[model samples]
Target: MQTVGEVGERAMIALFTAAAAERSDNADDVVIGSGDDAAVLAAGGPVVVSTDTAVAGRHFRFDWSAPEQIGARAVVQSAADIAAMGGALTGLVVSIGCPPATPVDRVLALNEGMVRQTHRLGGRVLGGDLVSAPVVVLTVTSLGSLADLAPVTLSGARAGDVLAVSGPLGGAAAGLAVLSAIEHGADPGLAHRFSALVDRYRLPQPDLTQGPIAARAGAHAMTDVSDGLVEEITTMAGASGLAVDVDSAAVPRPDGLDALAAELGVDPVRWALSGGEDHELLATFAPGDVPPGWTVIGAVGDAGGGPTVDAQPVGDLHGWQSFSET
Candidate 1:
């Protein structure tokens, strides 16, 4: 297999751009596509843009996940920001930096993964830059539009609003724990028994459509659970100038999470509350106006204590912090 150095930067750019163009759907919103100086997009209203970066060793490992999975994960986490704001994905600009010794096929597969995911979420790969670096780094800039709806923000929640989540939680965190255990020489059978959790950690399939649905249902505030449930709610409560009461029993959990947690001697609820990377939308809506697919887990109240689950103060449970050494 040829390395990226063998293909040269110019040829690699051509290859990546071609791959993105082929997978992109014909959309009226995209005026200029890949291989351009900059992408031109037709917007119906204010454009909602977001960017996320994934670094090798930190965000992913080649031995643990395929190039395709890594690529897909990048798009999912990036586009989720658009969804959290009650917008639909329009296009993406992905910048890739990797060592010259990286396999050419790996980079191409990564592009394919991104394009396929973008297409799946109603977006196109517009343009990006490819550079040589010491390790693989993927930066995905996602563009979106809210059409006729107003953009949902973090400070919109009011007292009496109901708090809900779009989908299951803790799966990603649990999956990470399982993968870490396996990497450290745990029984390989654990992989087969907990494949679902493993898959969740590798490639999270968050429902981006729920953001718009929540907005239409009159969500007051919304944010994605990239860090963890407890942390996100704490942020929302602080931003909204109100307190949130989370009913621990109401947060959804992935199937087999209990069993796996038991096997690992960990608390499943802890994982659900503090696990990050699920990318599920956490929003506050008017009571009874909660959308069909969302589960009501709590309610907004007057500010006092920060946030609580089961009416108890949220003490030690926390989410992923980028700067923290823990």
Candidate 2:
């Protein structure tokens, strides 16, 4: 098998550029696609840009996920950020740092995954960088067009607003638990039983369309649930200078999660509240303005307190922290 080192940097660049060109839809916004010094893109309004990274061993294990899944996850991480801002995706710039011994095909496969994801959001791969690193690292920068709409930020929420989520949560957390179990020799059968959860951890499918929908429906504040629900809401509360009350019964959980959690001897709701990486859009809307496809999980209240579930403070709920030890 040919390695990246054997193919050399220039050849790798040529290969990636060709791959991007083949997948490009030639959107009107992308004046110049990949293979250039820098991409030129047209935007009608304010642009929303977000960058995210995935590192080997920490974010993902090569043995646990395919290269395509790794690449797709990176795109999801940044694209969801644009969506949370109520913007339409315009383009993505992806950079990769990998050891020379990494297989050339793996990197190409990774790019293929990113291109496919960008295409789903009506975007193109504009440009990126390649360099040597200790481990395979992917950094994707996603750009979106606001289309003249005001950006929905975490600070826009106010007292008495309805707090909702675009889709189910806890699936990714449940999946991670199952994967950990399998890796530790708990039971190989668990993988077959909970493939959906495993897939969620590998590549989260956030509803990019719902962000704009909520925005149009008058969302006051919005954010993608990259961190756990509790952490995300608390942060939003702090930013907005308000308190939030989450209805424990209203939190959405993926089907069969409770069963899996029971089998694993865990509290499923804990995962729903504290597990992160689901990427579902969480937003605050007026009482009468909550849009379709969103579940009302809580309500915003006055300041001087933190988030609560069942009217009690959430104690020690933890979510993904990049710098914290695993």
Candidate 3:
């Protein structure tokens, strides 16, 4: 906690550097992990490194989410970050912090889940750390290579760019709602849809294949919708200094989203806008450059900065903050 509070990402990294200097194997390749906006890894090709964390109760609950599901979820979200960078997943380093009283079987199950998801997402765990904490906090860093390919960024989008999303939204949101409802003793129909939502929460399909496809198609800018659709679109808009107008109707919502929302007495649009965890790709394409896997959703506009849906402003326009108490 002191490392995170008194020190930022840089200073905290320096502490780790001092600790790792004692190790003999990684003496040379640990370049620039202490100072940059991103870390430097000595991959044969362009470096691709991304980090993600999953916590108990917020990101996962043991009673509702199984051990294997929680493990796989961690790997999926981390790999999604690399894919969002238009990089292929080559390796993952996992760190797990759990209470000492936690069962050994549960730990093994979690590792199995991580292995299964890593293989499914085209990656493997190169190394990891284990520590004791009050709750399970799993952090994963994924490394990959661009292989002489250009790195796609979230800031390349331009005005008049056509916006596209690769897959349907609202699946994970719907599933989470179902699980919540069941816990609260809601009706069966509303609760039965938990399977689909749980799938989104557990096994996020990051379209590992489409990042390169979008790049090949001349995508102006691209990102994964780990946050809700509205929030991520707005992020791209901010990064590119433009406004993104998403046609809400153009978003391909998955099966049972509306009815599930109705049962919860909530607006489906809210889930489509604010509810995150659906890790689909949202990108902007140059005119006549829409890729095969991408679906056109909206257009890049000039005014009213940040992200909007059908010309209406989206809430907050940011992804889930791990530290914000508000």
Please report, as a residue range, the 10-residue window in candidate 3 with the lowest summed lDDT: 1-10
TM per candidate? 0.98, 0.98, 0.83
lDDT of 3 by residue, 112-133 (tens): 6876777676655555666778
lDDT of 2 at 203: 91
Residue 23 of model 1, lDDT score: 68
Candidate 1 structure quality by residue, lDDT tens digits, 47-161: 9999999999888899888899999999999999999999999898999999999999999999889989999999999999999999999999999989899999999998888
Off by over 4 Å in 1: none
Candidate lDDT (C-alpha), each: 0.91, 0.89, 0.72
Q: How are the candidates ranked when ordered by lDDT, highest leading?
A: 1, 2, 3
Alpha-carbon error at 183 in model 3, in Å? 1.8
In candidate 3, position 254 carries an lDDT of 73
Q: Once model 1 is optimally superposed onto the true structure by TM-score, how far is the C-alpha of residue 205 displaced, in angstroms?
A: 0.3
Candidate 3 regions exceeding 4 Å error are: 1-42, 315-319, 324-326
Candidate 1, poorest ten consecutive residues by summed lDDT: 20-29
